[model samples]
Target chain A: MAVLNMVSALNQAFGGEMERDPSVVVLGEDVGRDGGVFRVTEGLLDRFGADRVVDTPLAEMAIAGMAVGMALNGLRPVAEIQFMGFSYLTLSTMISHASRMRNRTRSGMHVPMVMRMPYGAGVKALEHHSESMEALFVQVPGLKVVVPSTPREAKGLLISSIRDPDPVVFLEPTRSYRLMKEEVEEESFTIPLGEARQVREGDDITVVGWGAMMPLIEKAVGSVGKKGIECDVLDLRTLSPMDSTAVLSSVRKTGRCVIVQEAPRNCGVAAELIARINEGALLSLEAPVERVTAPDIVVPLPQGEGHYYITPGRIENAIERVANF
Target chain B: MLIDDYDPLKKRMLQVLDQEGKVVNPSLEPVLDPDVLMRAYRTMVLARQIDDKAVILQRQGRLGAYPPNRGQEAASLGPAMAIGKDDWLVWAFRELAGLLWKGLDPLRLYLYWMGNEEGSHYPPGLKVLPAVIPVGSQLPIAVGMAYASMIRREGTVTLSYCGDGATSAGDFHEALNSAGTFRTPNVFVIQNNQWAISMPRNRQTAAPTLAQKAVAYGFPGIMVDGNDVLAMYMATQEAVGRARRGEGPTLIEAYTYRMGNHTTSDDAKKYRLEEELKEWEKRDPLVRLKAYLMNRGMLDERQEETILGEAKEETERIVVEAERFPRPTVDDVFKHTYAQMPRTLTEQLERCRRLEGGGR
Candidate 1:
């Protein structure tokens, strides 16, 4: 086992997979010589030659659409969109072709690729680089949305996403890329795409969160536990297929639930999860589910963003209220 | 497919066989096989008949909206016959005739227009991509396929077709830039049909010619008489061979017209005058090809009548076949979205089944 951060873990995933599968190639802006803007794809160019690690033009539409073409030609590609907000220009290609290829061609072809980008707001980044647009990717019928919160999960989930037979939108949280360290495997491994992991076990209530908000929710749950409110924390690693069974069972036992997210309140991933829970296990809930989300407004510059971020105070307060309701 | 100098500022148009059936360049002429020449003529005729029939079908409410390639047959069918079976055909919505010439079933084309997913499916090993509707979007994907061919040294050239309207799209520009930067083996056949559904060519771009834009992408571009099927075939043949030799891409702008309405839903009569329509009708692609075949004594009046009759029968038979296709299942909506069904999609399918008493 190696104690690594998210960036290093991701680098390992690219190296390990590209070594295991010769067909695997990486393409993006500055991904080759510069490693990546975030250095998540560091050392790929050195490990693999220029033919395998491509430095594409500064066109998101082409980068996105080109992946579909390469995939159709029997090559597995991992395309990076540089940043989450920058990926907006790519949604036309992603939703139109990459996601729909398998269905449109009816199994005659598929986009076996990963579209990874640093997502969610933090670190006082510039405009267009701080988007938390996971909801948009999840709406497309064909794309799978995967969010990894820890180094271990980052390496494993990324590996799985690369190997998946269809296109996967692997959204890496910019706030969590270097936020913490974890003991991840030095050998090859994959975390299943549509499964949930229970980070903490408690009986009073269940707190669900993912990506950048997971660590915050975990700390909030621990803080609430010391104050006579024990909580269950389930990290939803995969958002689209969403381990609804795990979420429902957790709520069934605790009878109370709270969801935390960095995205806005309306039409966010939290809203969808709560709907799925109420659909399946509504009677089991002893209290109305509480949602702690950013306000439905554009994330302002860092000076005005304090009111918009989901902090530990907010998550803890929501959990305490739901547990004692 | 005359290769001459192109000035971006001063747009040049190329035509070999004239409106009155005369060759412009005999010394550098491409010798045509009589059977191949007649096949090209028959393809253009059948395409026109289908376009006319599709218009009537839409009027009678028997079909969904259909885009007619009435005046641009040579722009389409010429390039369609230029490539080998090993090459790939990336299509836009208007390349229906080209796809047909490439051995695609006419019934499948109708099925897709009729809104069935099954019609979009090309059987394995065809090397043809399903038609893309978004303008200029499939260009980059075509470039990527060519890039892979270069990497594997597969020598599979790609020929992608798009309308003049697609030239204004960002993806189209991006695609060409990538192709030029990588020198990918691909050919971009731009059918400048004079209209992007009401937006005329003059309004599409300030550039004098769409062919000249290829110079910005480091490729030579040529303007051709799109209605002359012979010209398109010759141009596409040269471009395809150049691509396979790793000589890079060529942008062929086939200056054609949209004689019919843009689509069944559109009414070109509202925008353009009947006088302009008549002017283009005088330069009909099939008429010129027919005249050339007759002048060469390869076709006579009786043979021409027989060819048209066979085309009508073939089209009608395919119409019957298309109508006989069973409605696609709802499973088509879920299957192939993933290799195996996801839990969320599985839940959706179960809900759909429960709603309608279940289905395949």
Candidate 2:
């Protein structure tokens, strides 16, 4: 085991995959000589050479569209979008074509590629640098969306996403990139998509969240527990193929559920989980699933985000409301 | 030999076998082996049969819609037959004939016109991409594939087929520019069949000729009579040879006329004059080919009738076989999106299946 922060873990995973497969390539702005803005690809260009660690022009659509063609031909491209906010330029190819290529072609082909972007707002960044728009990708077909909360899981999930025989949108929590360090496996492994990790077990209520909100949910669970309220906490590792079984099981066990997210509330994954709960576990004898989410507004700057965003206190309050109901 | 010195763009549309079925330039004539010529004829006949079957099927309510290639058989089949099977092909909507020339199955062709997505699925190693419905979109993809092949030293050339209207798209320019800059092995064939649905050629492009557009991309461009199968075949063969020899890309403008309505759903009477349509009918590829074969003492009236009758029978058999394959399930649409279903898609699959009574 090695103690690695999220950024270092990403560097290791990229280097490891490149070493394992000669066809695996990393392409994006400043990904070559500069080793990326966050150093997520540090030392990769030096190790793999410029061909494999391509420093492409500042064109997201070409970067993504060209990757689609590469994946279709033979290479497994791992593209970096710098930030989740910049992904809008690439979504036409991603959503209209990449997502529908397999379906439109009737299983004739696959786009086995991964796009990694840092997401969420909390670390006091400028405008458009931080956004949690995982739900937008969730709406598209033929694409898988992943959001990992920790260093250990981040490396493993990324490796799996690259190996997936379809296009994957891997969302990295920018706020948690270097916020903490944890011991991760030295050898590469894949944490299967669509599975959730139970961070804490309780009997009173279930707290579900993913990406940047996972740590906050865990902290809220502990705070609620100190008040004699036992709360279950689940970290949804994959947002698109959400671990519905894990979520519903936790909801069924506690008879109360509160879904939290950093993205705006309306039409978010939280709303999706609420609908699934009503459809799958209606007889589980629980109150309506509450959602602790950001308001339906654009991600504000760091100064205003503190006022608008949900915190552990906010999550803890939502747990109380759901448990009392 | 002077044969190797002939350029499709600089020289006259080279025709070794004259329209009267006589060897006009016997020395310049290609030494096409007997098997290759037969194969070319078979593919051309197959393409026509498929188009005729699609048209009748749409009228009978057996197919949802069809973009028939009735008047453009020679334009597609000629170039498709000129290339090797391992070479790559990217096609637009009206090029089923080209697909058939590259060994695409008749059953799948029927399935495609019947509105099933699975019909476009080519088997592995065939190197033919699925049909691109958004016209001209496949050009960039073809260029990308050619670039990859060049980088890997695969020695494979890619042929991208599109209509004259496709030349007006930004993607076409991007693909041509990138391919030229990289000197990738690619051939862009513009089947300028005179009409793009209801829009005439004059309205579609200001350039005097589609082939001239290739000059801007730093490549030689040629204009050949699309109805002359032999001319189209010879020009394509030269282009493919150049690409394989690392000479980079070429743009070929097959100047022909659309002899039918744009598609089964189209009404050409709303756009073009009856006199213009009648003029193109005289230049039909099948009529020209039949006349040539008759003059060569290779085909008689009796043989021609037999050929037409067998073509109709073969098409009916294929349609019957195609419609028998089970309709694609909704789950099939979600499969292969990724090798395995991702968690998010699994949830969607479950929801859809549940709504459909858990059948799929």
| TM-score for candidate 2, residues paired by index | 0.87
Q: What are the per-residue Cα lDDT tens digits for candidate 1 across B111-201?
A: 8887888777888888889989988999999988888787888887889989989999999999999999888989999999999999899
Strongest candidate by lDDT: 1
Kindly list the per-residue Cα lDDT of model 2 for residues B263-291, writing each as its tens digit.
88999899999999887877777667666
Q: List the residue pairs that clash in candidate 2.
A: A240-B344, A241-B343, A241-B344
Model 2 chain A poorest 10 in a row by lDDT: A57-66
TM-score of each: 0.97, 0.87
Over the stretch A171-285, how does candidate 2's per-residue lDDT look in tens digits?
A: 9999899988999888888888878999988988988888889888888888888888898889988887677889888888988899998999889999989888887787894
Off by over 4 Å in 2: A28-30, A33-39, A54-61, A89-92, A95-97, A100-108, A122-129, A300-308, B1-31, B168-170, B177-182, B201-224, B289-303, B329-360
Q: In candidate 1, residue A197 scores what lDDT?
A: 91
TM-score of each model's chain B: 0.96, 0.92
Clashes of each: 0, 3
